[model samples]
Target: MPDHQQRIAYLLARYVNKTCSREELEELFAMIGQENGPDIPGDLLEEIWHTAHPAPDIDYEQAYLHIKPVVPIRRSLPFRKIAVAASVLLLAGAGYWWLSAEKKTAQITTVQSAPAPPILPAGNKAVLTLADGSTVTLDSAGNQVISQGKVAIRQSNGQLLYAGQPTDGSIHYNKLTTPRGGQFRLVLPDGTKVWLNSASMLRYPTVFSGKERIVELDGQGYFEVAPDAQHPFKVKVHDIEVQVLGTTFDIMAYRDEQSVNTTLLTGSIRVNKGSVQQLLQPGQQAVANNQDQQLAVRAADLRKVTAWKNGMFVFNDMALPAILREVARWYDVDIVYNTSPATELYGGGIGRDLQLADVLALLEGNGLNHFRIEGRKVIVLP
Candidate 1:
């Protein structure tokens, strides 16, 4: 078997033995249904079954055949990967599927999908505001290069790239803004890459002429800075500034959010806010409180922090209001609450590419609250 398949087999064994870690379980779910991979062999499946059951009388072939007729696995499974993994666990007699058919039926009967509002996912859309006050609509702009003195700006393959160095010593700044329900990627002149989330703005100079390269951000952005020991890259988000020589990090500093977060993925970063400064290693996060002007550093779940860039919404004990705030930005919808919900925390991962109705449906299935979508507004009811 291939190395990846072998790894998967090993993971399956660990899973059946109830020894798989949360990260390993997530990896196993991600690998399911991956294309160009061989189907799990029967021998491995049998081993997994016996590891979980530990009974010699329970025949794997008979159990699989019995479930095959009832489950009906066609050429393609008409279910999400999480759902499939749940089914597999149930087949192994680990436990009942978390999303059982009875619960789904009850949810369907209570919530009607046809009348809900339909909001499409965000796309590669942003507006470039030049230094001269002229604007370029990136989504509608064709494959054409615009020149600002010696600097060349162009959009290709859904990414905005900057090439050619500035001739003169003068620096001209440009701004890229992504409205609600939009996102964009940009390549700075120093070969650094940035991913801008919805309702965010980035302001940067056309060239790096000074001792330090600095950029200002209004909302959230992920940075893959190019290595330059002499000229460190700095991102200023509101009151906090993140300094790095060459590192990958994400900064969340939305005006509406109470705190500014800087999560370091690779390399190291120095976060500064007022007189407070914190150095972050890999898998660490620095949070700056807007009101108290205090900086706190803690270990971070990198997957949850960077999930937005990977086309998913990952929550780790996230509050209801916080999740709704993200949903509002991504779907470009206003949220109205009839009654304030109790302090509720949720943890899960869902595809950000799904439609707003689909995402809301998943939330509604929990039966904790009701949602009514009217046009571009999502009304929350207790």
Candidate 2:
């Protein structure tokens, strides 16, 4: 095997073992869809499959059929040896298939362009505001424990946790804010865990008191509310209120969006807006339209709704403007359109951890829209 092919094999093995670094993962995916790239050896793929699944009767054709429904195949890219290798490995229960899917179909189209600086993905970073009007910049490097009265707060491995119980019967509120190109995970006093997406703000109590536990949210958040039957948990986002005793749900209430969406993953939630209210079950979504104040319920694709929380941007027949809005928020860049393309819809999921160049290339490759990155701004061209 040649040097490049050998490297691919090594990376594939490392990826199968869940030991590849982020940079290695990116390089592997970039090479997978190369039009004329070197072929991955069939024996190497068979070895990987046998090692991972030990099943002698497993049929590759049947396995591919199982994946065809869920795994998207890019019609633009030629079916290469890497695709076959991916199919075999995925059938053997390798987790690398998910990462590979993000890059397989996002090939950039040919375009004359200047080499613009790359914009990296957002990370676990945020600003925490205490009740005393003090702010702490939270990052992965900090290991300090901060105490305010009876409540203690600390960050470990990018997740902020609260220790100690509230005994003073006094309520103290703290706000966690993630700027553009940033995200954060927080554990509230009541053990409820929250994952805040980019450009989002969550105002929560340091310790629960009174009759109900309530929090105010602006922007997007995925919450796993701690079950407290007596003290119901309620989230207030704009004009909508989501009440649940215990459940996992996602709320998208960005000001730029036309409606507030609440996607329930487990348990049940009551979505209320003014006099309009609707109950949502698992796998269901409640949309509250801002214009008519009407609440609508529909079955939802949970994977697409919570893709951001899972480190992917899944767009399903999404509009161009909506897609650009998400790209701008996650990359912390401004978007300007010189001429809008005719109405276009996109369907695919890309890794949110990819650089702006890779993502823009995917968009351009689909022949949907063209973009030019200038400094911190992306300009759409005719």
Local distance difference test scores for all models: 0.75, 0.77
Q: What TM-score number comes out for model 2?
A: 0.73
Query: Model 1: which ten-residue window has the lowest total lDDT?
Result: 65-74
Supply candidate 1's per-residue lDDT for 346: 49
RMSD of 1: 11.5
Candidate 1 — which residues are off by over 4 angstroms? 1-117
Kindly report which residue pairs in candidate 2 clash with one another.
none
lDDT of 2 by residue, 1-382 (tens): 7898788878777776767765775576556655566666667766765665665644444443222112223444453432463363355445434344443333222332455456899988899999999999987677778898888998987889998876867788899999999999999989999999999999998888878999999999999999999999999998889999999999999998999899999999999999988999899999998788899999997878888987888765567788889999999999999897637554455678777776776565434467777789888876
TM-score of each: 0.73, 0.73
Best by lDDT: 2
- What are the clash counts of all predictions, listed in order? 0, 0
Tens-digit per-residue lDDT, 1-382, candidate 1: 7887788888877766666665675566557644433456556656666766765543433332222101112234433432344334445444222323333454356545555444799988999998899998887345778888888999876689998887667889999999999999999999999999999999999888869999999989999999999999999887778999999999999989999999999999999999989999999999898898789999998877898998888765577789889999999999999878536454455568877765775565344666777779888887
